[model samples]
Structures are given as structure tokens and as C-alpha cells.
Target: RVLVAEPRRIAARAAARRMAWLLGERPGGKVGFTVRGERQAGRGTVVEVVTTGVLLQRLQRDQELAGVDVVVLDECHERHLDADTAAAFLLDVRATLRPDLRLIAASATTDAEGWARLLGDGGTDGGGVEDGRADGTGGGADGSGSERWDGRPGKPAPVVSAPGVSHPVEVVWAPPERPVRPPHGMRVDPALLDHVAAVVRRALREREGDVLCFLPGVGEIARVAGKLGGLDGAEVLQVHGRAPAAVQEAVLSGADGGRRRVVLATSVAESSLTVPGVRIVVDCGLAREPRMDHARGLSALTTVRASRAAARQRAGRAGREAPGVVYRCWPEAEDARLPRFPSPEIAGADLTAFALQTACWGDPDASGLALLDPPPAGAMTAARETLTAIGAVDTAGRATERGTRMARLGLHPRLARALIDGAKEVGARRAAEVVALLSEEPPREYGDDLAAAWRTARHGGDPYATRWRQEARRLEHALTPETSARRGTARGGDGPGRSENGPGRGGDDPEHSSGDPGRRGDGPGRGSDQRGGGGPSRGEDGPGHGGDPRGGGGPARRGDGPRGDNLPTRGSDLRGGNGPARRGDGPGRGGHDPARGGDGPRGG
Candidate 1:
């Protein structure tokens, strides 16, 4: 059996489907896939595609990978932390227990030499890890070993370079005529997208089999798709992580009977799956990445220029099947200024989850692991501190019992904390729903209220709601009934103050509504540190997008809008999910579950 690990769930399914088609059978036959809560494999399945996270979980359960003969890490150049960790773990397995296991780091363009060195030739069975460096022809990171390269012990592995594309690709520079503002904090200049739409039209008019337009996010894809309407019966579809399953199938299946298709996609399409019939590529030259927002206590998605390697990958899509043309949406000279490769996720994303993973793996500080780049010192420190506060790790930087449970859930540490604690505050079902919503986030069409969004997902039959149901069910099943210390505490009162009694002990002497002893300087049962961070003036400790409210992320840290729910709860007007922000929707009203939007009660 061969196991192919893709970076995202969508890619896994698409890859499986593509393979199944080639085998003259449907999925569940020789080629199948298994993602987080979904699976489509049968006893006869020989090739199974899964997300990197799923492969990591399998390794945790059984390091031997028992029945599998080979493991392939597809799209190795993406540089996701999970993929890197998995590669390291796989190398370790190959050197020790699974000597017979074959590892392959597959990519259209990669530093065969660098990867060849990192993945020593243990034999033909030794799987090669990607060096993540770009080959000069374009398809990898810097290929510069100078940038914190993995110095792990391994002899050079054999190189297996695939030949270049058989088709020729013409490149056309299509920069907007007028100067446009650069992208910032999830906001892309409208002018740029408009220009991209124009470029797509030009491609369809002058050349083309099918047009594959690359955009940054789902929102951008939707906007570009919206503009390509009335294209004389040409189908406009979207391809992203959030895109519906049927849509993915159609995109991969190509336009039936040669009907035209304008498939607008995200970076996932860079190397994941080939959208059949695509010969014209429209490159927007923008990508979105997550960065920690220190002021907001949240991780914000920022829009930036696509890396040069990524632009090359996008261009390659056009020339996959035949000679094609790529419309570069920026000036040819400007391409020189673009970054060589995307910033490794380890460098910018919130490291709390990665830290917890390392802790659970028994290498809390990650000193023992072999990685391409070490975790940033400050980020590691912050992540460990957050984990300690959440009781997921001990002072010695080891995983606690609670931490082990959190790791098993495959959720962010903060969200897992919320799921466990909120299960006690609210019931298991409600808590799971809310946590799932917080984790995956409801669609923009799901309305502005978080609680209302849950109800919409519960009652609606749309693709987003279906996925929400699957995730919610998974969380609901994973919930542990163990009664913890944080259970039943007043919401937003998870500050530092020991209390075995009701409402916790802190601040000025006061009394809980239960007549038990409590503290003041806060709402009843609240703490002196109003924002709920364990620190003196910290503002975090939450499961909300407002992460580590001053300490560890949970809820009610920042963006605690008028409802004090921290999450954007729908009411008179909740903008950008910053919670309620209008008259009659201000905080402090009893009998209302600010988030639930029902009579359940107010809290996370």
C-alpha cells in the first residue's frame, strides 16, 4: 500500500479522484482517500491519499505504518510546519523501526540535490525528503542551505528528477495600467482583482482551452468568479479548501464535452491537482498568509505578493497538457523583487499548536527534533507560556494529562481548552457546535452572528453547514467528561487566583451569588485582571479568534464587543465578527446566551 500525504484535505480527495480516474475505476477501488472526518477507501484500495495532519496522527498511533509500503509527501515545497514535522518523523522512522519503508518527497520543482543530501540513500527504499530549495528553472524555496538548513545526519540520497514540461508556455505581463494600493491585512486592492478579471477575459478571447485564474483566498476567488458572468455559456467555478465537494469533482473532471470553464482557485491549486483542460493561466501575483496580531491578540490573515517560486508553479499549470500562455498580473521587472519562496509557516503562524505537538511528542523545547528552521525564540517562549496557563503542559515543559487529551483532538490548544471547559459550562453538544464554528469559522453567507451562525449551520443544508456538522460531530464525540478546575467558573474570570469555592478567589473580598466567598473589583465571580489573562494586566486566555488573551487564548480577551462574548455575535449589527456593536445590543443582559442566541445563558 502506498500513502500519499497532501498538505490540505481538498488536495487529498482531488488527487485520489484523479488517480482513480486513471485506473478506470472510481474512488474506493484501487485509489482512495482519508481526511479528518471523511474517508473513501475499501479493502482493495492500494493507494491512499491523506492530509499531512492525518499522517501525523497515524504515526502517533502506530509508528511502523504497518501495512503501508511507501509514503509520499506531495507538494513538499509548501513548507507547512506539519509537513516538515512529518518529514522529520518519517526520516526518524526510516532510520530506526521502518527500515524497509520507502519515503518520497514529490514536487514538480524542488532542489533534488539538497533533498538528496538530507534523505540519505539507505537503499532504494529510503524515502527522500524535500530540500525546499527552488531549482533555477523555478520550483522550490531559496535552495540556499544558508537559511537554517536541516543539518541532521544523513548521507546523500539518489536523485530522481522528472523531465521538464513537454509543452511550451508564453508569458505575458499584464500589470494594471494605473498604480494600485498594495494588499494589507486581508484586504486586497479592488483594482488588482478587476484587472485580473480583464486579463481572464483577454485569455478567453485570444487563446485558451480553459482558463485557470489564481487568486489569494476564497473571497478573492468568489469576486473574480462573480465578474466572469455571461461569458457566453462558459462555466465559472471556484476551487479552494472551502469549495464544495461536487465543485471540486467538476473542476477536476474538466468541462464536459469541451465546454469552457473559468476555474478560479487559491494557492492550494499551485501543485495540488491539475484542473483538466486548462491552457491559459491568469496569475494575480498575490497570496494570503497568517500573521500574529499582537494588538488584537489574534492571528490575522495578511495579503502579500506571491513568491517567485509560487508564480512559476502557477505558470506551469498552463503548460501542463499543451503549449499555453501565462498572463502575469504584475510588471515583469517587479517579479525580481518578489520573495523567492513563501515565508515558512513556522516563521509567522501562531506557534502554540506546534509547541503543544512537540510537548506531546516528549520534546517540549523542540531541541531534539530535526527541522529545516528552528522555531523563533520569542514565539516558542510565548507558545510554551500559553500552554502552561492552559494546563496543557507542566512547568518543566512536558505534556500534562490534559495536554495529551488536547493533542489527541487534533485541535488548536486554545480551541481544545474551550471544548473541554465549555462542555461543562454548556452541554457537550452545544459546546462542540460553538467550538467547531470557532475552529472552522462559518461562511460569510452564514450571517454575522456567531451563535446565530451555529443555528444556521444546524438547520441549513448547504455545503458549509454539512462540513460544520461533520466537524461538530467529531468534536462532540471527542469530548471528555472529566470535571476540571476551570469548569463552572464565571466566564472571562479565568484569571490567576486560587479558589476551590464558587466564583474563584481574587480581588476585593466579595460573595458569589451562591453565598460562597468570592472577590470583587470585577463582575460577580470575575477577577481583578478584567480581560481574563493570568497576568496582572493581561488581556487574553481564550478559545476565540482573540488568542492567548494576554496569556493563553480562549474567549473574551480582545474584540469582546458589546456582548462581551469576544466572538462576533449577531444582533443589531456585528461587523467583521468583532461581536455585537450597536444600540440595544450592548453587553449585560440576563437570560441571554450572548453566543447561543437562545435562552441557554451567556458565556463561551
Candidate 2:
């Protein structure tokens, strides 16, 4: 069996389709693909195409990869976190477990020598090690390598290069005349959009083949597509991560019946699958990079200058079929200032999922792995805290039984916790539906209220709704009791009420409500004590005996009052207010803090 891993689902499906065509069979015949929430493999399948995330999950389950013969890591140049981690772990397996397993990492414009070194080719230095042992003298178990296995460190694996067909691509500098606002917060300046649209019109009028324009993201793609107006005789289609599958298919299928096409797409079209009949390329000179504000706990996509490597990849799209022209929106001098390569996702992304995977892999701190880039220390600490809060890991930083279950669910650790806890509160089906919505946020058109969006997607007819339904079913299946039993582990019994007994549960007294017998609830000079169930003991000279007077000192702590159940419940609405505000209240009355109780000036 052969495994082909792609970065995105669309690319995996495209590769599977091309392989099936080459094999002279239908889509699910000898070649197949398996992406999240979808699978298209059959009994006779020999080559399986899958996303990098899917491949990582497979590695976690079966370290030995019992039956697979070869694994191909495609698009390694992208340097996605999953691909990088998968490559590192595969190297570990090849070195210690399966020397006979063949591993291949393929890319178009990657750091060949760096990857060659990474793949055990000692590079030009001849300093690679074979078995990672002190002596470094072990050979392959299967005797496939007389010296050591392919990619053993210090042992250089042969580099195989295949040259591509020659095609001249003319570079046309089309920088805007005036300085425009740089891309910020997903907004490309209108000035840049106008210039790009004009260039597209010029390309259509002067050039012959279809025009492929690159934008930073979906929002920009939509804006530019709208700016293009009516393309006299050409079809204006947009392709992005969230575009409908049919629209993406149309873009990839090419224009039919001699209709000239202008395909406005995001970085998704930079590489991977080729766009047929594309002879003109319009580069926007901007791309989106994943950024995390660790201090503020906010993660969002930030607009950034397109890297030189990405520009090269985008320009090559135009020349895939024939000689073409690339229209760059930035000046040639600016290219030198752009980053040479895109930042790896591990450097800035939230590492909660990666941390959990590492903990489950027996490397809690991820220090033992042979990763290209070690995870950041601060991010890993935050990840472990989140796992602990979710009851996925114990105080010792070991994966609990629940942690393994959460990891297998294929959702982020936080979302998995929400689903598991929500199921206990609500039904499993309802929890799954809500979790699915959280997994892939519903479109903005579906509205802001989560419940409303859930209802709309539950009954809506759009492609997103269809995908939501499929994901909901998968989540439901993953959370079933039978599945847990089959996995030979019981669900964790830790709940809010049982697991949160700590010193901070009370104020002032460390022994309060902690089941300590040394401290007495009622003491001399203390006002009427409720715990001892006695009334106030007043002096004889004091006022005439009155009914039981309540003690007044300060707010009662947990285990202090008669009830002894003052622990704050989890997910409680702790906002200060006179009472729950009514709907349609003004800003001051709508959950905003006012100067006083009633309507008054709002305070920060």
C-alpha cells in the first residue's frame, strides 16, 4: 500500500482523481482519497491519497504502520505544522522500527539540500548518523542498505531531480502609481483593487488565454471579483477555502465552449493542482499568515507581504500549459524585501492540539521528537494548562484515559471537552450538532446567535449546511458509548462538583469546608454560629433576649452557612447586575455596567 499526503483536502482529491485517470479507472477504483468527513477508497485500492492531518492521526494510532510499504509526503515546501511533524515522526520510525519502509518527501521549490540532510543524506559535509546510536554502525534490518537505511543520518540518500518542460514566462511590473494602504485586518485597499481589476482587463484585451488572478484571502477575492464588473465575454469565478465545492470544481474544470475565464483565487491556487489553459497571471503581492497574540489569547489570520518563494510559485501557475505572462502588482525592488519563505505554522499557531498529540506520544514536552522546529515553550505551557482544565491530563502531565479519547475524536481539545461535557448536560445528538457548528463556524449570513445558526444549518440547503450535518454525524459516532467500550477504556468520571475541591474553594480559612476536624464552626466571641445550629449567646446585661439574630461579619465562605454548599458552579453567569436585563434594552441596560443600579452613565 502507498500513502500520498497532501496539505489540503481539495489537493488530495485532485491528486486522487489524476491518479485514477492515469490508472484507467474510475475515482474509487485503484486510487482513492480520504479527507475529514469523507472517504472514497475501495477494496482494490493500492494508492490512498489523504490530507496531512489524516496522516498524522494514522501515525498516532499505529506507530509501526504494520502493512504500508511506502509513504509519500507531497508539498513539503509548504512547511505546514502537520507535514513537518509527520515527517519527523516518520524518520524516527524508519530509524528504530521499520528500516525497510520507504519514505519520500516531494516538493517543487523546496530547500533540497536542507531536506536532503533531513532525510539522512549527510549533505556535502558527510556528517549524518545512521541509527542515532553512539557507535552509529547499525545497518538496515532488511539488508536493503549495506551501510545503513536510506535517510540514516550521515548516510546521504541519493537526490533524484526531474527537470520540467521549458516555458518562457514574461514578467510584467504593474505596481500602482501611488502609495496605497498596506493590507490590514483582511482589508485590501480599494486603490490596489482598482489597479488589479484594470490590469485584469488589460490582460484579457491584450493576452490570449484565461486569466488567473491571485488574492490574499476569500474576502479579497470576493472584493476583486466584484470590482471586475461584467467581463464582456469571460466568466468571473472565485475560489477559496470556503467557496462552494461546485464553484471550485468549475474553476478547476476550466472554461467550457470557448468561454474565456478569469479565475480569482487565494493562495490555495499557488501550487498543488494546475489550472488548465492559464496563460496570464495577476499577482496581488499579499498573503495571509496565521498569527497568535499569546498575551491577549487571540488567534487570527494576519495579512502579510507575499514571500518571494510564494511569488515564484504563483507565477509558475501561468506557464504550466504554455508560454505565459505574469503581472506583478509590486515593483521588482520590493521583491528583495519580502520574506524568502513562509513561516512554519508551528512557530505561531496555538499548540494545544500539538501538545496533546505529543503527550499522548509519550513526549509531554515534545523535546524528544526530531522536529524541524521545536514548539515554543510558552505555547506548550499554555497548551498543557488547557489540557489540564479539560481533564485530559493529570497533575503529572500524563495523558489520562479521557485524554486519549479526546485525541481520537479529531477535534481540538477545547471543542472536545465542550462536546463531552455538553453531551452530559444535553443529549449526545444535540451536543454533536452544536460541536459541529463550533468545529467549522457557520457562515456570517447564518447570524450571530449560535442557537439560531444551529437551527438554520439543521434545516438549510447550502453546501456548508450539508458539511455541517456530515460532521455532526461523525462527532456523534465518535462519542458513542459502544465506541468507548470497544476501545477498552471507560469514560472519565471527573465532573465539576467532584474534581474542584481545593484551598481556593473558600476565603480566609484554609480548613473551611475541607473536611478538617481541627477547626470548630462555632467559637467564643463569634456571633450566632449557623454550623452549630445555635442562636446568638448575648450577655445578661444586653438587651432582652430576642429571637435568633443572624451573624454579620462578611460574606459567607464555602461550608460557612447553614447550607454548606456555596461553591460556585461552573459556567455560571457571574456578571454583576440587579437582575437579568430584558430584551431590547438600551446599551446601559443590555449587560453593560452603569454608574449606579438604575439607568445611568455607563462605566468601563
Candidate 3:
């Protein structure tokens, strides 16, 4: 039996105890625990073990264990990217390495029954157990070892011919029928922090186990924890990709006597790690993701619809150990808009990891295969180009040895590039720090800085400069102080050349201009032409339009000057300056009286 849990859950002393037991030196023999930092089980004994799911996966890749009676995968519901990959690999392992090994998956909240159906019922074939009861063991009437397979009565290891993987879960709706009123607030009705606090208060009053709250990002989690301030007998813990393992452990297992506890977490908790003893779940119905812009090659983590799978996972927290309650902030109708499945990581995320993984797997093109869903062609192309730029893949479409190493490190391609570059200049220690920061949430200062505005004006561009700044800060804070200092020193010493061939472009005179002629202003009047007296005045129509008619019997020509007929004449002078020049005998030419034959009004 293998109990899979989060990395922080496997404490050193607990691990040692488990190891002692596994070695038959202690009471609970056949039990051990392994993690990234420490691995101590009986030197040779192994029956029941507790391990982080990730470590087990790594071991499977590195070590090939033979002769295993059965592989029991507990807590199969996490659905983490690594977990999914591990499960799939285990299926293959069963086919190749251990054909006789029985695979039993246990999950209190996941659809284990559905999996049972998929694996076919282990029930006897047309042989009723009631008739075979005379044998004292509940075996089939045939009575040929149909029971006692695992030392239990009437329950043998059912031979399961994998009937095509379990049917996809369906969306079930239970309408609240509440009137959809325009929620009165400057922002959304469920101010995430407020919702979490409400859940926390209720959990405390009810003396329920620790409360688990799913928020969108690190900022929200912090904000809510801050709001809770200093509550006695209870500790508030924040969980997300950015938090340290120690902090996460403190939340998973609090102080003695089971004092009330609250955990404000990001989507990482939604499907990856399971927090035991959580009796209440508070869901804010939002998850932050990078809003991607293909054209600009940038993205921002904006709030988006959480998938149905994610929602289910959040709700499952309520019923994990026993029957519990879940408080959804939004109306039922709002939940309906969520996607039926978790957003394919390939589609929404930066493709660096996916591309590198595919390259290492020898499928450089990522062409033909049954991926649950494929990323957009443009995204795929961009990732391939990015990988090529980083020298992870050669021109011949093969992953270089360095690429394999990068994939093993599990980081985004851009960050991987930065790490590689940083390593060459700054050294491995600094490079590792940068990679770690890039993987987690950035710091507070980074989030607040105005200088972190988006470079592009597209949908996925850095529209939310505040969020980017926060992420940058989180990234910065995640690293050790020594590493942070080293990065700063390296950056300062690099001179101007360090940024020469940066992500976009850089030089003494940085230009945002794309340098495309189509983008340049090429119309009739622009720039200095307006001040050069080269274009039409403000209200006046140009060239073929606004002009006097009688002056030239047509529209006024350029450079011909203003028409005189339209000019107002002075009242003092009749035929001299400032007056209308007389034509023939008329003193006032424009007012000439034709009835007097031009002589009366003219008065010569």
C-alpha cells in the first residue's frame, strides 16, 4: 500500500519512523516514507510506503523494480500534471514490467466507482456466491479459488481487460432558481476576501475542521489572511505555488489540539495537493491564468472561468474525510459557464515545457497523436521557434542533451533560456535561483511598480500592469537573499551588452517602431507639413472643394490667391483704395443700378 501525499507532508522524523517500521525494527512493519530531500525505508524491506507522488514517479523512471504483487495508487484524484503523467506511465508499466501485478486505485472523492465500471466488475461470472456459502468462504458455486485472492473472502483480483478508458464525466446542474439581480457593488458581488472570511468565521463557530479556501491568486490569499489578522487559537496559512514548503506544512498540520485553521490558496490546491481534515470549502469561482497574445508574444495572468473539473475538485475538499459543506460565492448560473473539462495546459499556458517535452520524446513536430486536445498551430510554431532559439533542439529536429536536462528541470522555455544564459555568465547557483523564481509567484514590489506596464496593447498584453508587477515581486521573493544579491550583481556588471539581444530588442536608442512602411503615416498631410503652410487650414476645405466661384468662374486654384469679388469694400472710397475698383463708368460696381443705364448712380 502506497500513501501518496504532498511534499511537505512527509516530515523527517515521521519518515524515519516509517523507515524503522518497514525494516521490521519498529511496530508498523511494511511501512516507509520517501520524499525529495530524504528517503529512508528499511534498506531492503518494502511493503507499505508513504511518499510524495512526484518522488515515486521519479523513482519509476530511474529504477525498475521487479516482483510486485500489486501497485495500489491511493488518492488518484489530485489530477496534477505530474500525477496524470505518472498514472499513464503506471498503466504502461503494468502492461510491460508487471503483467501479474494488480493495480488498485483508491480515492474517497474521485470517481473510483466509475473506474471500477471501466475495469469491469470483479464479480463471479454466472456463478452465484450464495450457493457457494456452504464452503464458509463467499466463493462462487464453481469454487475454484474464486475468493481469498488477497486473503479476503469472496474478493479475488478481478482480471480486467481495459475496456476503453472510463467515459468522460458529465456536467450535472442543480439550479438555485434565485433571481438574477444586478449585484450592487463597484466590483463583483463576491469580493473574494469577504467570502473567505465568512467561511472562516462559520467554520470556527461550528468547530469544524480546518477551512480550505480557493482564491484566484497569491495576492488574494495574502489579502484575506491579512484581513483575518491575529485570531487566537487559530492560525491562517497561505498556499500557492509561491509559498515555501515549510509554510505549506504548517497549514497541512497545525499546532496540537486541532485549533481552528484557515488556508487561503490558489488553484494549485484545487487539484494537486490534498489537505486532510478540511471540513469546509470556500470557492471564489475564479482562477488566474496568463492571458496570451500571439501577435505580441506576451501574456498576463487574468481571472478566468475555472473548469468543471476544477470546480469538482474544490467541492471535493468538503467531503474529503467526511460529509462537509461547500460555499460557492457566485450564483449557480455563473458556474454553468465554466468549461466541462480543465483547460488543457497545452492550450492556455506558454508552450515552452510542452514543446521541450515533445522534443525530448522524439516527436519534434508534435504532429500525430491522441492528445486530449492540441494547442493552436501558431502557439505550437512559436514554441518550436522558441526552443530552437534556446538551442535545445537542433536544425534536424532532435532534442540536444541540454534540452533533455532542461525538460527534467521542469521550467518554461524562456526561463530555461535565461537560466542557461545566466549559468554561462553568473554560474549554476544563480541560474538555479532564477529558474526557481520564474517557476513561482513573483514579489509584492514587482506587482506594485508602475514601470512594469505592458509593452503591447493586445488582449494578452501586460494590460494588468499591477498583476505583472506582483508576479515579478513574488518571483523575486521566492529566491534566497544570497541568490537575489548574486543576480543583482551579475545584472549590474553585465554592462550594456547584456541586454543587446534581449527578448524584444534593445540599443542606445530603443525604438518601439516595427519599421514597417505600412505602419508609417503616408496620408496627404502629416507631421511638419501642417506647420509648413502646405496643407488646408482648419475649417477650409482642400483643393477640389471649398473656394470662391466668381473669381475664376471655378474653384479657387492653389497659389492663385483669395478671390476679390468676395472681399468687403469700404464705404468712404467709391473707386479708389479699400473700395471696389470701378468697372467702366460705375462708381459702385457691385451696387450698380441697371435702371439708370449706369450713369445716375455713378454720377460722373
Candidate 4:
């Protein structure tokens, strides 16, 4: 069996289909694909294409990749963190467990030598050189110069040279007439999108084939696509990670006969999938890279100049079928000034998920994995710290059972935690839907309201909605039996905010929990014929003391001031507040506990 790792989901599916077509069969027949929430493969499949993240999961589950004879990491130059990690894992497998496994890293642009060295020496560079092929067969005479594979484990993997058929891509300087400000975190100058849109229009007028314009992010793609509006004789589509699956398919499928297309895409198209009729490329010369704001303890995508290699790859999209031209939105001088290659995601991106994967794979700190570049120490530490807080990993950075479950859900730890708790509070279906939204953010058109966005998904027939439903279902199914059962139990009446006393019925501390901040007796003693926590006072309004409105029954006292005393709360906020919730608020009655479908919180 052959497993091909692609950086993006679209690429995985498209590559599978293309390979299956070339084999004169439908996908899942001889070639199949598996992405995060979907799979189109059968046991009869011989070649399977999957995204790097999927491959990582497979590796964590089965380190040996049993029965898999060949593994191909495509588009290695892209430097996606998952791909790099998968590559490192495969190298480890070959060196230790599956010595017979054949590995191939297919990339056209980056330093082939560097990859060969990394692949050969298990991360260390110094090694004997080899010009021969590994085990597996390849073309020696097709004239395309593409390397044929041979399986073998050697000091540094063999470097097979490929000089496939090519056409010249003419570069044109099409800088904006007016100076535009450089990009900042997620902010691209609107003027640049305007310039890019104009360039697309100009390319359509002057160039012949379909135009593929590279934008920095999803927002930029959307803006340029809007500027293109609805073009006559051409279909304008947006392509990126968040693009509606249908829209992405349309881009991959190409336009109708005699119809042109202007595909505004992110860098995913750089080497992932080749748009069908692309002959004119509009290079926006911008890209978004992940950056960890250490001070703020958050990760953000900062827009910057696209690396020269990325620009070349984007420009090469135009010349895939015939001679084409690339309209550089920046002057040629700037091209020379750009970095030679895009930074690897591991360097700056949040490493929590990656760290979790490493922990699951037995490399708690990932120090042993063979990588093109090591993940930053500070980033790894931060990630481990987060894992510890979420209880996803132990103090030793080892994945806990919960962490393993979270990893299998294919979500970030935070979202995974939300899903688990949400299922108990809400239901499996509801938790799945919301988590799916957070996982692959809704399209811009979905609006800023999450609830509204969810409703749109529930009723709309748009591709985003379609994909969301599919993902939501997948997530629901992924929920553990324990979690699903817990949700069912909650719905059956024994869940959060449901104690038979009042809204916040729970084990109570004495004296208004002594956490209330009102003047001495003003807090109204706890046992004073009144409760002031999750529920209302049994008697009157009671004291001026509500313990903590901040929920969490965490460290604060019931109806206490903000952040409260250091003493722990009696129990979780599950039962309304610091005391037993009233039967009305309980699951069986007309209580207004928001946990279920109830309207809101109610008094004791």
C-alpha cells in the first residue's frame, strides 16, 4: 500500500482523484483519500492520499504504519508543521521499527539536498552521499526526468533529479501606482486588494488563459473576489482553507467551456493543486505566517511579503498548460529583496497541538524526532504548560488518556475541552456543531454572530453550510461513548444547574460563604433563612451579598466580589451556584437553567 501525505485537505482529495483518473478508475477504487472529517477510501485501495495531519494521527496510532509499503511526502518545500512532523516521524519509523519502509519526499523547489540529508540521517546532516535510487521502480527514460522510486535505507536518502517539461513564465512588473502600506497582523492594505483586483481585470483583458491571483489570507481572498464581483464570461471563485467545499471544488473542476475564471486563492495553491486552465498569474506578493505573541500568550497570523520561492510557485501555476505571464504586484527590485523561502510553521506557530502529538508519540519534548528545523524551546514549553493546565498531559509532558482522546478528535486542546464539557452541558449534536464552527471558522459571509452562523448552517444550502453539517456529524460520531452517554444522562435530568433546591444548589460554605464583600452583617449570614449564591435567598432579597455572579463556582464565594477569596468554592457550578438548585430549575421542572434548552437562570 502507498500512502501519500499532502499538506492540505483539498490537495489530498484532488491528488487522489487525479491519480485514480490516470489509472482509469474512480477514486476509492485504486486510489483513495482521507481528510480530517471525511474519507473516500475502501479496503481495495492500493494508493491512499491524506493530509499531513491525518498522517500524523495514523503515525501516533500505529508507529510502524503496518502494511504500508511506501510513504510519499509531497510538496515538502511548503514547510507546513504537520508535514514536517510527519516526515520526521517516518524517518524515525524507518530507522527503528519499519526498516523496510520506502520513503519519498517529492518537492520541486526547495533545497533538495537539504531534504535528502534530513531524510537520510535522521535529522543529523553529516552522512555518506548516494546518487542511486531507493527501493521502488521509476522511469529511467520518459524524458520528463522525474525520479523513479526504489526502497532502501541508506546514510542520506538518494537525491533523484527531476527536470520535467516546462514552459517559460514571463514576469511583468505591475506594482501599484500609489504606494501602499505594508501588511500587519491579519491586516492587508485595502488599496492592495484594490490593486490586485485591478490587476486581475487587466490580466483578463491582456492575457488569454484563466487568471490565478494569490492573496495572503481568507479575508483578502474574499475581498479580491468581491472586487471581481461577478465577472461576465468568467467565474470568480475564492480558494483557501475556509472556502466552502463546493466553491473549492468549482475552482478545482475549472470553468465551463468558453468560460474564463479568476481564482483568488491563498498560498495553498502554491504547490498543492494545479488549477485546470491557469495561464495568467497575478502575484499579490503577500502571505500570512503564524507568529506567537509571547507577551500576550497568543498566536496570530501576520501578513508579509511572499517568499521568492512561493512567488515562483504561484507564477508557475500560469505556465502549467502553456507559456504564461505573472504580473508581480510589486516591483522586480522587491522580488530580489524577498526571502528565498517561507518560514517553517514550527518556528513561530503555536505548538500546543504539535506538542500534544509529540507527547502521544512518546517524544514528550520532541527532542528525538528528526526534523528539518527544531521547534522553538520556548514555544514547546508554552505548549506543554497549556497541555498541563487542560490536564491533557501530565507533569512529565506525557499525554494523558484524556489528551489521547483529545488528539483523536482532531481539534486543538482548548476546543476539545470545550466539546467534552459542552456535551455534558448541552448535547453531543450541539457540542459537535459549535466545535465544528470553531475548528474551521465559518466563512466571512456567515457574519460575526455564532448563533446566527449556526442557524445559517442548519438551514442554508450553501457549501459552507454543507461542509459544516458534514463536519458536525463527524464530530458527533467522534465523541466517546462515555461523553455521549453523559450528555444523554444530562438531558434525562441529572446534569449541571439541576439540584433540587435552587439555581445554584451545591454544597455550601457557612456565613454567606464568608466570601461575600458587603458590610459585615450586610452579607446576611448564609443560614439566615436565605441563600445568596447560585439560587436566590430563600426569604427576601437577603443581604447586599451575592457571592459570585462569575460562575465556575471556581475559587470565589457565592455572591462574593470579583475574583473572590482564595478559599475554594463548595463545588462546581453544575447545580446553579453555591447551593442546591430548586426543583423548578432542575431538569424535570420549569426551572430556567440555561444548561439545557431553558431560557435563563432562575431563583431558588
lDDT of 3: 0.38
Cα error, residue 225 of model 3, in Å, equals 1.8
lDDT at position 89, candidate 2: 75
lDDT, candidate 4, 1-604, per-residue tens:
9998776556777899899989999898889987654567887999998766667767776899888988888877767666677888887888799877778787666656656656665322322112221222222222122221223333445566555545788999999999998865445678888998999999899989899887655446556677888687988876654455677788888777778888876666777578988999998887655456666444434556788777877877877778999999998777788998777878886677778888988898888877878889999998888778767899999999988877766555655665665566556777677655544334435553344556677888876577667757766876865553343211111111111111110111011001111101111112111222121221121111122232111121232221112112222122222343332221111111121111112211
Estimate every model's Cα lDDT from 0 to 1: 0.59, 0.57, 0.38, 0.58
In order of appearance, the predictions have TM-scores of 0.77, 0.76, 0.52, 0.75
Comparison by TM-score, 1 against 2, better one: 1
Q: For model 2, what is the error of residue 470's alpha carbon versus the real structure, in angstroms, after optimal superposition?
A: 1.1
Model 3 scores a TM of: 0.52
| For every candidate, C-alpha RMSD to the true structure in Å | 12.4, 17.4, 25.0, 14.8
- The superposed Cα distance between candidate 4 and the true structure at residue 553, in angstroms, equals 17
Q: What lDDT does model 1 reach?
A: 0.59
Q: Write the per-residue lDDT of candidate 3 for residues 1-604, one digit (tens) a residue.
A: 3433331222222444545745657624455544322234443535534332333334333323354454445434322222333333444444455554455544333343233322222343311111111112221122224322122344223322222211122222322234322321111223445655665675577646777877654445555677788787787787543344456566555445667768776554553345767777777665533324455343322345566656776776666466677776666767778775444334553454456655665567666322324557877787677667666788866789766654433234444444444444334553343233222222223321111211111113231233233323423432333543343321111111011001101000000000000000110111111211001111111111122111101222222211123211222121111233222211111111010111111111
Q: How big is the positional error of residue 540 in model 3, measured in Å on the Cα after superposition?
A: 46
Judging by lDDT, tell me the better candidate of 1 and 3.
Answer: 1
lDDT of 1 at 473: 70
Per-candidate clash tally: 19, 5, 12, 38
